[model samples]
Target: MLEISIKPEVLGYIGAFPLTNAQLTSWLSSLLLIVVAIVVGVNYKKLPSGLQSIIEMVYEFFQSMAEDAMGAFGRRFVPLAMTFFLFIVVSNWLGVVPGVGSLVSIHDPAKAVSAGIIPFGAPAVMAEAPPSADATVEEQHAYVPVFRGGNADLNTTLALAIIAQVIIHAMGIRTAGLAHHLAHFKNPLEIVTELSKILTFGFRLFGNVFAGEVLLTVMGSLVVVLTGKLAPALPFGLVGGAIAIPFVMLELFVGAIQALVFAMLVLSFLSLFVKTDQSASHH
Candidate 1:
């Protein structure tokens, strides 16, 4: 059976907090990056060579861009822009990692359907009513994966967008002054424009990652179904794993592009403000 969830499913709770699979993956991504950074920093030398040299060059590229874009604020901007790029890149790539989507939690289907953890209908393409208490034995079980792509969840992407927008509008205030920044609220359309940037940021990442996830899931499912007849002893829709390789590679590429696109867009927006300020200062 294939399960596709557009929304991140809440797996459990910690005190008052609701823990979703997307959030879990995001935390794992952050932790992994932190550990790697610690290891690298401890061994880090002033002079670069090999992979270290390559990494330093990449950092210099972004650091230089940020400095050029924001001028005085660029140094401050480097940390944030770099963090967003690294975190997003890792989160996107982690989606295609083995076992992230394969590990499943067993649940009673009636309970799963009732809780909205699993949807209605057979193999569940179409929505229907929940199964009754006395449902078929086959329908009594559900396999819910415990991990998902961090950016695939709207909440995660929207939160990142919200943070970026804060910096963007703050830059507007600083470069143009409070009077000019507040003037944006005078026009309802301007207010909407401001709001739209956040939505655009959030939805763009979420749509790409979520669509990729669905594509991989459906593709794997289709491959398994087609091959089931040839390997009848193997569980239906469980034997074909090799067919998804190209797609996994494609997703990895897409993930990197998305991360770079997001970082560049933020840098571009900041640069526009810096240019405006510089022009105003000259006049």
Candidate 2:
């Protein structure tokens, strides 16, 4: 029999996390980043080569983004901003990798579905074999995590948000002093302002990244369902694949943009305090 469609079921597994897809993607992205850092460090050299050239371009891009957003002293925030950018981009791109949500081992209804170690039954969306028909089997079985992607979980994105807030506040305090930083919470007047900032940061990041994932999912589903219907008019599967390609590429760019936007907003907000501090110091 044809392998049962498993994409939705695998997606459901990813959804079981506390955070949304964007967050989960961020976590995977962070791991990918750590690995990349190690590789870059290990292969550092006086003259840049193929891989180094790409890394250098990334660095320059971040430098340019920072300069445009945070001005001359934007170099101060480049490390954080660049790191965030790379992580987000990688996380977003990982979602488009082959077999991310489909090629996982799952239950076989014709044979016997087995439970996974996670205490939940694996969604038998796809089956390698219809289970061995000849033998008795246990009710539950350990299934491996076959399909995985970075941006599929909300926890990862939220973690990035938390990190951004922490770094932003820390930088603000360092630049403007503890008293001034705490001033963000002073009085009901300030509460309204600060709360708005917090919500804006959280929701903007969440909405953009989550929306991208949803769009990709919907498009992918449409292609899967409609390719046959549209086959005669065009090379439906090929066209669908082509259409999906650009979105994944767009996600890569958007991820970097969102990260840069988040980081720059933090820097800009903190810099505003710097001006306040200097004015107060003069008095």
Best by TM-score: 1
Model 1, residue 118: displacement in angstroms? 18
lDDT of each: 0.74, 0.58
User: Per-candidate RMSD vs. true structure?
Assistant: 7.4, 8.8
Q: For residues 32-90, could you state the per-residue lDDT of candidate 1 as single tens digits?
A: 98987777777788886665676677688788987677655566677777788889989
Off by over 4 Å in 1: 71-73, 109-141, 183-187, 227-239, 274-283
lDDT per residue for candidate 2 within 1-283, as digits (tens), equals: 1122222222222223323223344456677778877888899998988777898887887677666654556667778777766666676566666655434444444333322122235554432222346433223322323544453444455566677766777777887679867876767887577656766776676667667766665565465465434232345546666777778778777777776687667666655654342345445
TM-score of 2: 0.64
